[model samples]
Target chain A: MTMAQMDRLLFGDNQFFGINHMSEEKARAQAMRFQKTDAIMEVLDVAYAEGIRTFMCTTHDRITEVADRVRADPVRYADFRFYPCMPYAHKYANAVTDHGMVGALRHFMPSDGVLSTALTGGRALATKEVDGIAKVLIDMEMKMFHGLQTPVIFVQNVFTDLLLGMGFTRALRIFHDHVVTKYGVEPAFITMNMPMLLEALEKEGIERPIICANINKIGFRMSGGFDAYLDALRSGRVRAVAMSVYASGAIPPDEAIHWISELPGVESIVFGASSAGNIRGTKALVDKYMGAPA
Target chain B: MDHKVRIGVVGLGKMGLSHFAMVNAHPQVETIACDGAGFMVDVLGRNLENTIYRDYDTMLDAERLDAVVIATPSRLHAPMTTAALERGLHVFCEKPFCLDWADSERLATLAADKARVAQVGYHYRYVGAFREMKRILDTGALGRITHVLAEAYGPVVLRPKRSTWRSQKSEGGGCLYDYAAHPVNLLNWFFGTPAQASGSVLTPIFSDGIDDQVTATLGWDEGPTAQLSVNWSDESHRKMTTRITMIGTNGRIFADRQECQVYLRAPDPALPGFEAGWTVKYTTELTEDPWFYLRGEEYSAQLADFSGAVAEGQGKAVENDFASAAQTDRTMAMMIENAETGQPVGAPPVTARPTPARKRGWFAWKA
Candidate 1:
């Protein structure tokens, strides 16, 4: 995925779902505030009005309602497209708990891959076919975004790091191939440990894999440290999407944007905001620093 | 009649040997030992009168063990625990429970089904200073805690060493999982599950792929916000230095290995002998020196708890059970996710407090 194709400022869904890393009180309040789809839409509308057309969001259960609402009012969301991140693992875990494993798999199996996926899932579970299980699961996760424009599909960090730790590089290839072949979208892996993940993906014969990781000053949560990340960016060995630009409320906004703008390979910064003012403020800062078009 | 719990110790590494010594010292326990390293197994065989085997499975097959303590590298934790649990043996495995949350969850389920006294080795919880802190918090003297800060720093892995499993990420290397687990588990123990978290993992100060430092913020839906900062690269300290500070509406409590300090804004009857201002209590003041305080009291305390639970036959909920360890795993996962995604990864809130019933009209206050 190239910088031009992805909007410099991509809106994220954590704020709407009541996720605030710095303060649980605020997170709970926001979650209560946006419990309804309309409340989420109102915030999304504010972001949309402020010129953020790309919504980079997890495949949260509530997000489907937002997607349906957006789809219904095409005129309002005419330019909106999704950057769907997948394997909302908690959803799957809960599904498995409520239903049996096979029943959960059936519940999420796409219409196109129902039979094949079911057979593959069963065989994979029984025989420990890692690639087969991964392929079916990715397809199942993409079912919610069937009619949407998903130019980039992310493997959320939870699953991505798990694969990295297990050294299951083949699963990365499977995700890449299936996303490209079936959805015709670029595959991106989100990981807390970026340098190691980048090397892992490259080892799997994936050249310049799109990786999203924590990149900020203070090296806040950047694994391998900030200098290593800077070296990787300067080397141009991979495509990078910078998240946690604010260091989860640590760095000031202007300094965050200014520091990130000077970085070599970061193509986009994903951020979440609960109010219109914060949304517009962040957008203005990105436009100022990154020269993102209004 | 001999009623001592028959136990096996696996992976005679630093922790394994320590646990073996503790188990041997316990009057209520008899121990067998195993290690992949033949020399370590031989040494253990010579040192202890207990049986010794090079392979863990062979020991399990040959010996009748009531319980087992696994001190293997993190990658082996899940498999070893599962194998022991399958054989109907209670287990006390070392920290980071498993490298992956999926494996941890699976083992948790198995342990639950088998009704085994499974516990993760988070020895810091058994420290006297922290136990006193827990006692204070449990008394509600802290009064609606608002924030908790946990810091652990040391020079454990200060230089580049030969590639061991601890230096490899796939093998659960790094301070993030190993050293940071103490503070993370402590936070979970002190404030329950966080509603959300975000942080960064830093590495390569000493080794590659193994994270040497981690800084994270864990937020609860209502109670307290928590922050953790751990570094295994600090060269000033010879051993790990851990400190936790809890901020509450009425007071703040700070604790470490040696001492605990409490500052209260107002006097509460809940805390006897503690006045409205500041109070300092050392660990020496709190806990009596034990009979076999050789490898630290916390380690002995955890083993004693595990032994008691094993003796009980039914799985009793211990402080650091598989489920609690899994909660730490989930929090670590969220921290990693937040660090990578730059968004605060959300967790389910702690039990939601009931909204107070409001009386209607102007006479509500009077009523």
Candidate 2:
């Protein structure tokens, strides 16, 4: 995905769910404040009002409510498209805790693929079929986002890092193929360690993969380092989605935007905000620094 | 003979050294130090004429100490604290208390059994602004608190390579244990244990398996709610910044290291010093310049309190004791579990509130 294809300022679900990098106190406050779907929609509406129509969000259970609310009001959300990030691992993890592993798979399996999925799930578990299980699980996760306009689906960092650590490079291919062949949209990967992930993706024959990672001036949470990230961006090999450009609230807004704007190949910047003021302010800053996203 | 509390400090890293300096400077306290790093022991031995050893056990055996300050990593906190308590020494372990809740619980039990002063270093509690906030809250100036927001942000672990023991999951690395402990302890200080907790996300911004960012919501049975957001990866904050905002029925209190702002809808006579409306108090007004201030007033105040407790034979009720610290650890564990499982990890849900009736017309309410 390129800058033109993706929204320069994509709204994120972290704020809606009370995810804050700096404060658990603030996160819990946000969670309670945005407990209702309407509260979440209010923030999304603020982002939309500020000309940010694309929402890069996770497939969290609450997001299904958001997708439903958006789908219900087609006129208002006419231009809205969800960059559905997937394998909200907590959802599956919770399901497995409540119900057994196979039971949880069955619970999430699509209606048409119930029997086949069950057989595949049983065999995969028994034989340790990592790729087969990954494919099935991806399909299962994509089930909630069935009718939404998901131009790009991302593998969340949890699973991405897991696969990366396990050296399960083949799983990335399975996700890419399924997202491309089945959904007809490109697949993206969210990771903390982007350099290694990008190299792995290239080795797997996936060229110019879209990878979202922490790309900031201070190298906050950048796995390799600022230099490596800069080198990767300058190399123009992988498409980069820069998140945490504010470095988890460390850098000043203008400086952060200006620094990131000058970087070579950052295709998009995804940020989370809880209020209209923050949404408007961030959008203006990005536009001022990045020059209206070309 | 000098009537002073003789204290031995173990794990002379960043926090240990700070404590050593504070205790050494106090007129009423004498200090000894130990660390696994021989160079650190040598450095402290050279500076202060106190006994310094590379091994904690050797130092404990060699020195006649009334108390021990344990500033080791979270994984080692429990063992060191238990050993000190068993040795009949008042123990002060740094924040996080321990890596696991079970271990913290065991340590708390040991401390209780030994009848020793066991304080966990939640230095924020001693900070002038937060202390003032706590005092105001105690006066019921804000009425019944409806919600609280605690935040701690810093750029300490911005890169993966900067990962220390704090970045390792086994060693209690990440913002959750290292940074979140402050806000978690603050929340528990304001309100007792949360009745229910959910919607947790532990994000590893730079390193896998190391949570650089943590968010969670805690609900109290008495209607108060709390939110915690801590990100060690935030580069915007030059240093770790902690802020707590409490929304109460009658007013609000927003406090950080710099200042405390309290807003009241109506002045309560119960809170004598506070006015009816908004009041902003700066830390400069509340803080006192200590004779030997090295880190901050809060750090000095905490060490002074620990030393005083030892001197007066009143170390048993040092405010931030192991029991309370263990409660914070338990809540944190629940939040982490909730984040991992995507489920509510605390007590069973209370009865749901009734949904409000939908509006029929703009004038419906007036009519």
- lDDT by residue for model 1 over B1-367, one digit each (tens)? 2588999888876577667766765667887878885333532344345677889889998998898999998899989998999998899999999878888888888899888898999988888788999999999987888778899998766666656677787888888888888898888888766788866555567686668888988888877777788998896553577889998878999988766889989878898988998997766446543323333557767887888888877585477999889888888888888877887788644645634547565655666
Identify the candidate with maximal TM-score: 2
- Score each candidate by Cα lDDT: 0.77, 0.78
Q: What tens-digit string does per-residue lDDT give for candidate 2 at A200-282?
A: 79988998888998888876666655677788899999888999888767689889988988988897899998878888889
DockQ of each: 0.01, 0.01
lDDT string for model 2 (B80-137, tens) is 8878888899998898888788888888887788778889899898877888899899
What lDDT, from 0 to 1, does candidate 1 have?
0.77
Worst 10 residues of 2 chain B by lDDT: B38-47
Backbone clash total, candidate 1: 2
Model 2 regions more than 4 Å off:
A1-294, B348-367
**After superposition on all CA atoms, what RMSD does each candidate show versus the true structure?**
19.5, 17.5
